[model samples]
Target: MSTSVLQWNLFLLVSSRKEFFYMDIELPASLKLTLSIVNSIPIIISMFGFLGNGKVIHLLGFHIEKNPFTTCTLNLSIADFGVFTSFLHTIGYIDQVDTIVYIYLLVTYFFLFMYNTGQYLLTAISMERCVSVIFPLWHRCHRPPHFSTLVCATIWITSFLLTVICIIIVIFRVTTKPLFYLLLMNAILCLPLMTVSTLVLFIKVCFRSQQRNKGKALTAILLALLFFLFLAFPFTFYVSYCYYFPHLHSLMLIGFGCSSVNSSINPIIYFLVGRRGRKSPSRVSMRAAISRVFKDVGDCTEDKKSRTESKVMI
Candidate 1:
């Protein structure tokens, strides 16, 4: 959901033959303490995300809704749970955790899995959005119902399998190509899809009067994507460039810290946007509100299931 800039804390570890040792870079004492406090902020947001998304999932139950938008949002919420919890461990709280060598590496690898899975998932959502806008008829008529689920499954499985394989390689003294590829994959996959999503939104949806109903809704999504792109830029650049100038590591950490702000802001967006007045049609549930916003120009079917059940207070 945050479009996942990994903690960049991997640079903080050294995999020795028997064990992985930590190499702490000493920033100023005040800076470290400030970071610790700042770092705790995401946990609050993460909790909100977990519960907020959890509520949406509960409303849907075992049934998959017709909206791929809801499907992607659900997956994103699941990823957020992983992102938030794993994220907590990598922050200033690291020293407090039990750090048995293999255990620590497993945790590290799991964090990698969650973060990258989220990033890939966001890209998947972007690609889907692009297709929905560009070829609405095809999306509604020909697109497989399970396509979003499949995309989510692909992201999760690939992220997990690749992370485990890469961790095994790192732990057993194999080539570092896995790590290289991990960074490369993160850098490459997201931007193109996001760019297309944004371009398509601005070009086709933003200015068109016929799309008025979906405009606010689509704009909400686009704003989030744009914010993520803005936040992701320096961090992505640092991930590539830090290989040469290691001093940039600190800057990356700062960039990472700023990037985490997205986690906090996201749930706020949903809550704020989903809010409704006393006399409004219904209390805004994420699914119903989004489905309402995205009600297409030509399609007549509204997601009435969500609209009727939309008693969710926030």
Candidate 2:
């Protein structure tokens, strides 16, 4: 079955003529390599951060804390990492014309879909934050950590199911019309949600005096949303064109390249304008308090052991 799938993917790659290798305008190989390396930076940083701090934080039971922002950001980083890795594989196979290359392309398609879904999830997170800030009372009643987790889980599961459905549809139908429809549906559904979330975030930032310093935060979200929109819009249009006019294969290839840029931009935005770089003294103090609590627990445990030994000796 795996070999059959691989063969089918390779057939798709060869027959479609829209693989990433062939471009209309000549781009220097060195420039392409440079761009690919630059784009991979965000994925690298986010993967490391997500793997490093994310696990430690979760192990410390901090995942259940009242910080929806942190939890959502962590999940976003993981999703970004997934998107990045997938795109990196695609980039690596840009010149290859083999079954393995097609497999990488197939994986890239899956991750592109995943990346779109992740954008929606991130927008949902922003909406949750907006509600919490703008409607604090209602947010308290409705948007607790458990509620957020449930929503996040639902987004993930729904995305996975949807991706599976898309793959099944593609495999069975094998027609361009369905692909166009699928891409259009995804774009129409996601773009508006992202736009609204970005707007709400902006409004929330503007209204809240305390959050005025969060201009950078608002900008980051806006930039990320714009990045997504820019990448997705062209891909959607290219897919539509491919359905109607298959000769425009080079356009499709370029669109994929542009879309690859989206996966690499989120972590850079976060690092530059998001929470990681903006850690205030209050956050440091909170970390210190947590460390102290752990130390106190250890000291109590040691004291209990010592007392038990003394009692036994007596």
Candidate 3:
């Protein structure tokens, strides 16, 4: 859709040229009040997420041994921060006197990029865990230096490029059909892979006796992925609704907020798991949590590798 088409749509939506997307969105007084109260959460959560993830990343880099897993996590933190910053922009625009639809489009795609990046990283994390366990010898011997880093770079670049394309789509005002197909492609490409990988990881964690009682790392991953799925499900649902039931389009504030909360809550989950079953104060608390999660699972893998005929890398 071109600017002219959007302008026409805008004109059709409201006689006053200034009114944009949300102006026509019907909301009950109760819903409005709910939104007003709930709207304040993302910023606070985003702020805390940024600081907490920063601390975790710092600890990982300087104190903990770098690995494929840690590298993916570092990228996850960066992506979460990107989502946070995008939320900040979105809230800034939505709270304004006159919200420009174009700003919304840009911020929406930014959020999409961050969200998609996280999805890929989640898939990578699961596959990495699976690979490490299933192919310990080959993984220890054959995996190349900086290979994981390259994979992370590819994930980031792919997501960023798709985001740019999305932005271009909106900025150029492409037609409704193209928009639907783009979103449909996302539904097809991203969500199913996420579900399958999560399921596979969960199975590997649960049914494999060797993995049982291994540190709580898998437990933590399962929890984060489940909680994130609960919160993030609505956005995918909404995308389909937009394509199939266009006339029924409604921006459910609570659902959108929950999706943002997925990113905001991750650092906290990492902190909790890192510090799980411990009691300590401020600075001392974070002192070694980074090493613990990595090392707990490390001991389990080490025990298994102890019996292997092939030599393993340190």
Evaluated with lDDT, which candidate comes out highest? 3
> Which regions of candidate 2 are displaced past 4 Å?
1-66, 93-96, 206-210, 214-219, 274-314
Cα lDDT tens digits for candidate 1, 1-314: 11122233432344323333643334466655666665566666566656665655554445434465666666766765665566655553444333433444555567567667766777777777777778866665566756778888888888888888887776676764465567677778677778878888777655686845555546656766776677754555665665556555566665554445554445445545444322564666666654454344213224333433574533
TM-scores of the candidates in the order shown: 0.74, 0.62, 0.74
Which model is ahead, 2 or 3, in terms of TM-score?
3
For model 3, what is the C-alpha lDDT against the true structure? 0.63
Candidate 1, residue 67: the lDDT equals 60
Question: Model 2: what TM-score?
Answer: 0.62
Candidate 2 local lDDT, 282-314, one digit each (tens)? 354334432332332234334555766898999
Cα distance off (Å), candidate 2, residue 60: 12
Model 3, 47-114: lDDT tens per residue?
A: 77678767776877777776666788788878877777776665554434244655555565666788
- Point out the worst 10-residue segment of candidate 2 by lDDT: 1-10
lDDT of each: 0.58, 0.55, 0.63
Q: Candidates ranked by lDDT, best first?
A: 3, 1, 2
Weakest 10 consecutive residues of candidate 1 by summed lDDT: 1-10
Candidate 1 local distance difference test against the native: 0.58
TM-score of 1: 0.74
